[model samples]
Each structure stands twice: as C-alpha cells, then as structure tokens.
Target: MLRRIPSQLAVALFWLLHWLPLPLQAVIGESVGELLYRFASRRRHIVMVNLRLCLPELDVTERQRIARAHFRALGRSILERGLLWWASAERLKRMIRLEGAERLRALLDDGRPVMLLAPHFLGLDMGGARIAMEFNCVSIYARQKNAVFDHWLFHGRSRFGDQQLLSRQDGVRGTVKAMKAGRPFYYLPDMDYGREDSIFVPFFGVPAATITGLSRLSRLTRAAVVPCVTRMLPGGGGYVVELGEAWADFPTADVEADTTRMNRWIESVVRTMPEQYYWVHRRFKTRPPGEARPY
Candidate 1:
C-alpha cells in the first residue's frame, strides 16, 4: 500500500511530463541529474568506481567530467519516460532520427530472424520506442516490483508497436517462439546478470559476468545479430538510433569465445561515447570464485 503511493505519483508525473516540449523536458532532466550527482552518494560512488575500472587510462578529472555528463543523461532518461509512454507517434517520429533503415528492411525482407544488440545506453528505451513504431519484436522484460509502475511499463512499451516483452523468467524459449512467429528480437544483452547462464568475459578488460544468450539464441534460432545503439544528441536535439548490419560467422560453437566477442564489440562502441554507456550499474558485482567483490 505504501509503495503504491509513490508509483501512483510517478504515473501521474509521467502523464504531466509528457505534455512538455522535449527540449524543455531535457533541460529539466539535466537539472534533476545535477541534483542527483550532488546528493545520490551511493549511485555516484558506483559510477565513479565503474569509470575508474573501465577507463584506467583516464585520469580522475577526466573521468569525473564523464561521470557528470552521464548523470545528466540518466536524468533525461528518467523524465523522457513521459514521451515514451504518452507522446503521440508523430511527435516521437519527428524527434528521433533513424540510421541504417535499409539494413533492417533488407533482413526483414529476406525472411531472416534478427536480434537487435542494444547496449545499456541511457537512451535505450528511446530506441525501443522508436523501433516499436516500425516492427513487432520480442525482447527480455524485467517486471518492476510496484504494480502501478509495472503496469505503466507494460502499457508504455506496448503502446507504440506490437511488442512481446518476455520476462527474464520466460527464458529463451519465449524469444525463440516470437522469432519463429516472424517478429525480430530486440536483445539488450549487455547487462551484468550475475552468474546463471553467464561466463566470465572481459569488458573493458575486467572479467565481468555476461550472458551467452546472444550466441545460444542465434545458434538455436539462426537470428542475425544487428548491433543497435541510441545517442541522446546534445541540447535536446532529440536522438539518433543507429543500426549496424547483421553479423556473419557468429556463434562459432564456442559460447565463451562468442561472449568475449560480444563484450569486445560493446567496449569499442563504449569508447566512441563513454558518457552514454550505463556506468551507474554495479557491473562487476559478481566476482569469480575466490575473488574479492569489487563493488
């Protein structure tokens, strides 16, 4: 009962926020982010720790700058939930620009299954919302604890396109079923999901725990892995969702090696935009046996 109070408040807020201009919402979000950076001590610590580990070459001052920018991005993402949830299709389409449209088209036209490899960028949901406008797809879903929030999430994600968001408990079979039904899977495979179905792989040179689902899913479903990322343009210039061509020669019968390859690819993309990758997460929480926990 107590929890529902705040979630109901958040739902109300999302509706209110959705009515504002996107650029104005972004400005407000940046202010909120600054506040979070100043007072959200625990999350700030995690972000700094991640930066220190992942970007060893960067000095403290440089990393701090990146961390600050990241907070601003994170804040914008929070407020942008309104747009994802309540904004009209025309409004969203005008703001979000798409790249590599033809590549995705070609894959769908060829009757090939696809797995959109979306990393944990702050504007990730934006990419999902935009793609939802065009394609019907399946992806992993994590249900929020609060009922109001969970309902809001489900409603917002499904409002744009015909998407089946299978929960983590749904396992690979749900995804395979969806893909077989002709819906591409929007696979966001770059989070730290402890050690079940995960292998120790190098991410930014750290032996982080990562899921080998991409390889296994592709192997089972023969889905083409298409790398997708969304960049929140500066000054609320909206966003850019970029898509890469399908990966060839993937899932080479070695799950560990394939996971490593995926991580390496993510690391390279993170290098292109360090501040946008999700650094606030305790990505290295699960240590190898006999290894000290870094978080």
Candidate 2:
C-alpha cells in the first residue's frame, strides 16, 4: 500500500548502508545525530529533562554536551543495527566481543535458571544479537506500529540461533515458562511501564515507577540475576558485552527492596557511560501520587 512506502525505503536504506565500512558509517551516523540534536525539539527536550533530573550535578552546559553525545550514540546504534540485521554470523562475532561469558555459562552448566539483566544501552540490540548467536534465549519486545518495520525488526532479531521473541502483551507467564525450561531470559527491566505491576523505586535519586518483574521472575523461576552491560566502543571500535557476576542472595523476601537494589546497580552503570544510556526515553514519565511527571 502507499502508506508502506516510507517504511520500505527506510529498510532499503539500512540495507544499503550496511555495506559501508564501520568507520565511515560512524561518521555519517554522528553527523545525522548532530542534525537530530539541532532539529528534533521534542526528543531533545526529553533528553535534557532526563539529564536535568538524573545528573543534577552537571551544569546546563555540561548536560547539553552529554545530551548531544547521547544523540550521537543513539544515531550510531540505529545505523549499526543494519549490520546486526544482515551481516554474517562470522562478521558479527568478530565485532561483538563477550567478556566474562563464563559466568553465564557456569550458571547454566550448574543447571541453574539464568536471567540476563540487560539495561537500556545504545548497543542493546547488538549485544542481544551476539547472545542469540550462542544461546537459544527468550526476550520480550514491544511491537512497532508500522507493520513493515515490525516484520523486519522481528526478522532481524530472530535471524540467529533459536531465539524466541515474545510480545510485551504476552505477559510474564510465558516468559517465566521459557526461563523454567532452561532458556536464559534476556531481560531488560529498567523502564517506566506505568503503575501496573510497578513500584516507585529511586533511580538516580528520583522515584521512578519501575516494574517489579525482576524480583518476581527470579522468585518464580529461581533464576540467577547476571548483569549484562553492552558498551559501544568509541568510533569504529566494536562493542563489548560485559557479563557481570551473578548476584548472590538476590530477590529477598521484600520485592521493593530487591527492585531498589536493581535500580541502584543500573544507576552505577549509567554513571560510567552516561552518553550511551537510553536518555531519549521518558524514564521518569510516570509519577507517584501528588508528584508531577518529569517529561
């Protein structure tokens, strides 16, 4: 149909762009990001608001600098996703290096249920793609409004391994069932999904409405929470998927406390690479009773 032309063109462009060298792609992507930073007023405002709330110590100018840098990272991520979608398994493996992978393998070897606590980072898709190459994993994703784009997104992600993509609307029961069956869950729990099944937890000292699914999932499946942080190296340098040691004695009797601990750990990681974090998202959108929304 006529309405699908734009989406078709976008996919074609991504396919074309994937053929270029990474360094050249990085240059073009950053340039695109600079343009977005200047012209995309709404997204720029959201990023600024997030920076203002989360990194209050940074002055206006510093926050602006970080915001611009974040847009550049986001731009690179969008462009590089083409590589993830079409590049060969060998080529992708060469670019994405997994550090501390044994930690995850050890848990699985011990017949333990594993949950990969992947936060929102620019290289999230690349990291997930890399993991999918090695393990038959399960992840939850929201469907895109555009049917053309949605089909490609699902195809790109499911291209490698026996990866299973569950719709966000499918809920935790299906994901829990997957986790119980020895499939490692690539879980991204650091987003504001409103008040349902979420509690107000302090993220960067701000009360963020975070889903309590991490603790609940762990409790139900007895999964070990291993933090997976995917970092995009500067310029043409490839990505590194760093797997941290699994948390011991996690998901205690109190779900609130467990969620708080998860947020604190995510905050620490974001501090290390502020520009790569998903700043464009309205992280603090949902507010507690009597509190105003930040975005």
Candidate 3:
C-alpha cells in the first residue's frame, strides 16, 4: 500500500505535466532543478568533480556556474519526458530540428550497419523518440527500481520508435544482433561502469574507465560510426538533433587508441554544449587500479 501510493502519485504527476504547455513545463522544471542543485548534495558534488577534472582551466566560479545551469537543464529534461512520451506527432515534429540525418539514412539505405554514438545529453530521450518515430534502433537502458516506473520507461521509449531498449544486464549481444540486422545501435559510451570490458582512458585529462565497445562493436558488426547529439533549445524552443557524417577508418588496429579517440571527440562536443551534457553522473567513479575513487 505504501509503495503503491507514491507509484500512483508519480504517474499522476507525469500525467499532469503531460497536459501543460511545454513552456510552462520548462519553467517549473528549471525551478525544481534549482532546488535540486541546492539540496541534492551528493549528485551536486559529482557534477562539480566532473567539471573540475574535465575543465581545469576554468576557475571554481565558472565551473560551478556550469554545474548550476546543468541542474536546471536536467530538471527541464525530467519534466519534458512528458512531452516526448505523450505529445502529438505534429507537435514533436515541429519541436525537434534535424540536421544531417540524411547521412545516416544513406548509410542505412545501402544496408551498411550503423552505430550512433550518442553521448549522455539531457535531450537524448527526445532525440531517440524522434528517431524511433521513423527508424528502427536499438539501445541499452538501466531499469528503474520501481516496477511502475520501469514499465513506463519501456512503454515511453518504444511507443514512437522501432527501438528495443535492452536491459543493461543483458549486455551488448542483443544490440550487436540489432546492428547486424540493419538497425542503428544508439550507443551511449561515456559512463563509469567499472573495469570489466572497460580500459582506463582520459576524459577531461583524467583516466576514466572507458569502454572500448565502440571499436569492438564496429569491428564485430562492420558498422560505420555516426555521431549523433541532441541539444535543448533555450526559452522552451524545443530540440535540435544533429547527425554527423559517417566516420572513416574507425576501429583501426588498436582498441585503446580508438577509445582515446572516442573520448577526445566527446570532450570536444561537451565543450561546445557544456551545460547540456549530463553532469549529474559520477562519470569517473571507478579509479585507476591504486588510485582512490573521486566520487
């Protein structure tokens, strides 16, 4: 009964926000994010550490400023989930701007396997929804603890797109199968998942347990890497999903080198849209063998 009450309340909230104008939702989201910035001490600390390590040139004040804006963006994304899941097709099409998707389409049309390198940006769900509206894609997702929440996640993500959200525990086997079968794998490669299939690579000049999945998958499936990113428009403007040209000479002989190259590319983009990047994650949680964990 106790768990059921909050589950019902959460669903009620998703429904309530689903009815509001996106602009109004944006306003409330940012306010709630601001509150989180002030009160969510643990996550706030992780954000700070990530910014500090990744962008050492910036002073403390500047870094904190980015962190603050990050929380606000995070909040907006949380609330905007309603729009992604429940909004009309015309409404979503009008809101999301696409660039260079033809490049991806061309590759897919030619029957070449493709892997979309999607970073952890706030607007990524919106981007994925938009892509799934027309194309079949596969991606990994960590299940939410609450059964209701988990079901909602699966439903929302799969409703608009030919997306198969495989459980993280299921690993990359299913995703590889999807890619081999001509569906684009929306691969999010930047996160600390310990040192199982990961090798320590520098992100923001600090060694992070980075996955070599991109190169390995590409080599395994012969997929071309298409870098994709989505940015939230300020003042409730909507989203921009950008797809880059397919990378040539990827997964070149060395996995570590390829991993480093991947990190370098992510760092470059994150620099351009610093605030939109997901900073709430403990990206550097697993340290180098003897080094102490930062978070």
Candidate 2 to truth, TM = 0.97
lDDT of 3 by residue, 201-276 (tens): 8888899899899999999888999999998999888899999988878989899999999999999999998999
Candidate 2 lDDT over 1-295, as tens digits, reads 2233498887888899998988888888888788788888899999999999999999999999999999888888887878988999998898899888788888888888999999999999999999988888999978999998788888888999898889988978888888877789999999888888999989999999999988998998899999999999997788999999999999799999999999999999999999999998999889988988777
Candidate 1 residue-wise lDDT at 185: 89
Candidate 3: what lDDT? 0.87
**Worst ten-residue run, lDDT, model 2?**
1-10
How well does candidate 2 score on lDDT at residue 288?
Answer: 85
Model with the higher lDDT, candidate 2 or 3: 2
Estimated TM-score for each candidate:
0.96, 0.97, 0.95
- What C-alpha lDDT values do all the predictions have? 0.87, 0.90, 0.87
Q: What tens-digit string does per-residue lDDT give for candidate 1 at 1-295?
A: 1133477777787689889888888899888888888888888999999999999999999999999999988888888888887888999999998888789888978888888999999889889888888888888879887777788778888997678988888667778988877788888888888888888989999999998889999999888889999999988889999998888899789999999999999999999989899998899999999999877
Query: Who wins the TM-score comparison?
Result: 2
- TM-score (C-alpha, index-matched) for candidate 1: 0.96
